[model samples]
Target: MINDSELILNADGSIYHLNLKPEDIADTIIFVGDPDRVPEVSKYFDDIEIRKGKREFITHTGHVNGKRLTVISTGIGTDNIDIVLNELDALLNFDFETRNLKSEIKSLDIIRIGTSGSIQGNIAMGTILASEYAIGFDTLMQYYQKPYNSKELEIQEAVIEKFHDLTFKPYVAHASERLLKKFAHDIPKGVTMTAPGFYGPQGRNLRSQNTYPHLIKQANTFKVNGYQITNLEMETAGIYALSNMLGHHAISINAILASRVNETFASNPKEIVDKAIRMVLDRL
Candidate 1:
């Protein structure tokens, strides 16, 4: 059993999972899934203070245009988010040695800058997508005691009714408006669908059949009170859920890499990602 003390630190006094301390992280954090992308995103930082890595996780703390920020690679999926987000919150809000909580908990502003596919035809390749809301098809939220929004619950029920054949429970949540307003002008706003996997879960084939035949079509045409589904990714829902429960702000900005309907990929995918990262950094 991991107690508060055991969960607090490593023998070297760094954060347990991230290998970072409170001093090592900035108030503003940017998350990417690929470890190699850590340096790619941190390249724009004017002054870098720390660079650390453990397993697949890589982190860089730096300053950009006088604003301090930290970029971390979360590996992949909601399971990774479960580790990264909780540890990050602990780093900011809890005292490591004493294992005592702070009187005034500090909240961090987190933004996920990653790649995703567009389910809508109007949302083409090489464009930037900002998630106004995220629909989680993962099980992480089953452990939380946070109150569910009635409107969101209604939407979830409708979605489930429309596709009752699927095995998982549907979960939906919104992003932090405060963070969205900060980088609003940098990307197109839409609802992001969080899938469990990139292949069959997202309606892709592998020389075999899928459980949901029209899942992609259902997702593309899915609308809640007239809100159209925009992009599809794997991590944003978990980020929003855990961040909201912990009192931190979270949002996702995705570079449109693939189009499900058109079956197209960005011609210059690297260039698209580079532009999106630069734009986000400049805005921040």
Candidate 2:
């Protein structure tokens, strides 16, 4: 039995951070990093059954094409993913009435509907990318044990070698194959590198200097076993890594908003984002 002090639930039986109960979410969930984006995704549902919000965590559960589904906001970053995934696991695996573990557990299908920048020049703006691998440049996954096998060593080595200018060690984790087969067929497959922040961590320059001046360009050209680095984002690697360990299936669908290779931004990003969101919703 987990103690109430450590595994706290609200008096109303909702999870503390998400203000959600076991029934509030469906096993198939679509996660967006922005709070406002939650409704945008849920608006396509046939009928919304539940709506809950707390801090940056907003959840809307409903039916789409006779299938029950959920759209939730995770704010941003893997740090928030740590909170969201654990609380979600606890919500399903713990008995709210008894505050004890359940004998049977359930796995979730967590799909991220978010935005990213294309590191490769050929990937046009507004293209939807299916992450074959989400590599983390952040230190979040390093806090855990090793997440790769011998096969991914070459991919990991390539990331480390290309981003050598940075101080932290990088790790690579692949997306859920089950989810990929179902959703990403006929789409452009690429590796997504998740940065810890929006600026310097992604090689942006301002007052402070960047350790890797042409980091994005470097990642764009990186190739190992003929698989090239495709894009950059902030949440995919965290989502993939945590979900892999937590028994949840996860995948990220990215809207290309910028092109680092050509120094271009999407002329109408929300249009692209909306297209990407609808694309995932249609498949989900």
- Using lDDT, give the best candidate's number: 2
Name the weakest run of 10 consecutive residues (lDDT summed) in model 1: 1-10
> TM-score per candidate, in order?
0.95, 0.95
Model 1 ranges with Cα > 4 A deviation:
1-8
- Residue-level lDDT of model 2, residues 95-209, one tens digit each, is 9888888999889999998999988889999899999988898898778864576646788887787778778888788889999988899799998989989998787887978
Q: Which ten residues in a row have the lowest lDDT in candidate 2?
A: 145-154
Q: In angstroms, what RMSD does candidate 1 have relative to the true structure?
A: 1.8
Candidate 2 achieves a global lDDT of: 0.87
Per-residue lDDT, model 1, residue 94, is 76
lDDT of all the models against the reference?
A: 0.86, 0.87
TM-score of 2: 0.95
